[model samples]
Target: MLHILGLTANFSLTLQHKDQDILNVMSLVESTKRELQKLRDDGWDSLMAKVASFCKKHNVEMLIMEENFVDLRNPRKRTNISNMHHYKVNCFCTVLDFQIQEFKDRFTEVTTDLLICMAALSPIDSFHGFDKDKPVRLAKLYPDDFSYGELLSLEQQLDIYIDNIRRDERFKSVENLGDFSCLMVKTQKHLAHPLVYKFLKLVLILPVATASVERCFSAIKLVKTAARNRIGDQFLSDCMVCFIEKELFDSISNEKVIKKFQMMNERRVVL
Candidate 1:
């Protein structure tokens, strides 16, 4: 899913039957797609690259990409999926095949700029996606105080929050709320394709970065219980860096650590 300029584009698959056991297929086809000029001088390197460029054109400044985002559990899907086009965001469902019409109907009238998803708790296994996680959950932590009661009623609390996001202002939209609610109810509208993984796998490279940090912070809140709420700022910062990404810390040579340790160790380990 992607959001830009009060528009939300969603993709999904499901199964359905038509006429005497015959089948009707529908999917997201990127027909009549538009390109936003001058966002970047570089053209796309591949289909996945195009998706990233397309996302950028949609005016999404930041993209969170995951490695191996797609999960192609079915082997035959290698040739089942096809190219898709869009001038704007949308949602659609298909069973046993791709359906473009369905995608159009879901996203045509309404425009949504922001996507709120509950942060994923586990490592991303593939391009598998769940729209239910609220993306705006992290934003709530930014000293943007809302009463506990108000937070529970966020969707009802939404005051057409699209414009606020366009202006880069604080807009009260909960993360993954739509994914969990509107999108979830519509899940069975489409059919899963074998090539679903390829599409998503290709897409992962396009996003600017992965939404890993959002999940990390959410985890932090869970671990740093009320008893640890008052922990020192520096300690927490260091812990997050090491816990979430020790590789970055590892990039520093042991020699550097040793030198620092010689001065500060004093029987205590330090970075």
Candidate 2:
């Protein structure tokens, strides 16, 4: 468990980063999956050494791993398994196998490819992350969004788009994708590269990074506690939105709120 937790700590840190883009997040996911699999394959001896060191430091008695493992509560049931097998196979390998399977299940090949293709839309380092082929492939992923003709047009547009954006002084100051997107609109580049802009918008909308979703889920715990379990979905959603965007709501005056509510329906009393 300790070794597994240590390995997963990197993933936790990556997920927690506020400025993480889809490109990096997707890369992290693939790297983490590889690390976990590598650990599962060749990490038994190292993990056991760490466990032994901890047990020694704490004065915990080491088990005779070669002896048969017996359940004290169920002595009648004769199970033939050594302590080594029980700990190494039943515990360590089992946990590692489960984690490996989870990574595989969550990040299937198709999903990973989709995310990688989306990463081509990242606008970091003066559009250094841009890939013309990948975005064209990304457009292929969603046939409904990009018809056959548009796909062809997207390839041509990407050629001009990259050239134009790279030369434009206004886009040099753009940092993240959000800023790049805003600058594109401000300079009317989005209109010039409509297909590329559409792909950019698609990348922006994908929930590739977990921070925002995790934040909302954490807020849900506070907003919908046991005491407030009966709150309807609509009301709960409203409460969550208010709680999540408190800064935005705080800027609105109470008088404006009252007037907004006053307009919702006819009331006998006026405030």
Candidate 3:
């Protein structure tokens, strides 16, 4: 039971998508299937049989009976076995099957499209596995942002953009969408691959984990405690943004903030 619990925890960690690619997800799934198959083939029944034989040979069963190690009477009175090893083995198999089925249901091929699109934005290996079609399909999903002509132009733009970024030493080490976006901004190449950028932006904002939403709620609770419960919605929103994106907020110069604030009002205090 403890072994199964450990496997469950490890499997959950594999599903976590922090800085992960589509290939990584697929690899984890394949590895999990292998582990589960091994578990099933090695069957808990065999382990139970060995354990029971060991206890019986050592007369440990007599000791257990005397010490009341197990409840001999079933509450339901459905079985006559002294030990419930068979039922426990069946229960373990059932749980393992359920976990496998749940994993398959949650990560079917249809759900991989977004992941493939996100993987195309990878900056490593010269973006060798980058798929233009995936991002194009992603753009088609947002018809408002991409017309047929725009998509064709985007394809051409992506070819150029990929070539440009590949040769540029500045982008060689970028590992995530956030850093890639900053690099684009720094190099002023955002307009070059507009559709790709849009798709990348969508990928960047997609919830990698529910914990991020939970974190936002945690921030709200902290920022809107009893003392500040009456804060206006706009102010609350601003506070949340600042709290959630503290790194970005920290990057802004106080001079730039003061200048913006001064521009917002006719009168301003000297800093």
User: Clashes in model 3: which pairs?
Assistant: none
Taking all chains together, the TM-score of candidate 3 against the true structure is: 0.65
Candidate 1 structure quality by residue, lDDT tens digits, 41-103: 122234357777877899865333322222256644443223231112111112101233444
**What lDDT does model 2 reach?**
0.84
Predicted structure with the largest TM-score when compared to the true one:
2
Please give the range of 10 consecutive residues that has the lowest summed lDDT in model 3: 62-71
Instruction: Output the TM-score of candidate 1.
Output: 0.24
lDDT of 3 by residue, 9-71 (tens): 766665543345566776676677777767766867675777789888988752332222244
**lDDT for model 3, on a 0 to 1 scale?**
0.72
| Cα lDDT computed for each candidate against the true fold | 0.34, 0.84, 0.72
Please give the ranking of all candidate structures by TM-score, highest first, separated by commas: 2, 3, 1
Residue 225 error, candidate 1, Å = 5.9
Tens digits of per-residue lDDT for model 2 on 51-120?
A: 7998999999988889999888997887699988988899878998999888889888888888888777
Better of 2 and 3 by TM-score: 2
Q: Once superposed on the true structure, which residue ranges of model 2 sit more than 4 Å away at CA?
A: 51-61, 224-242, 245-271
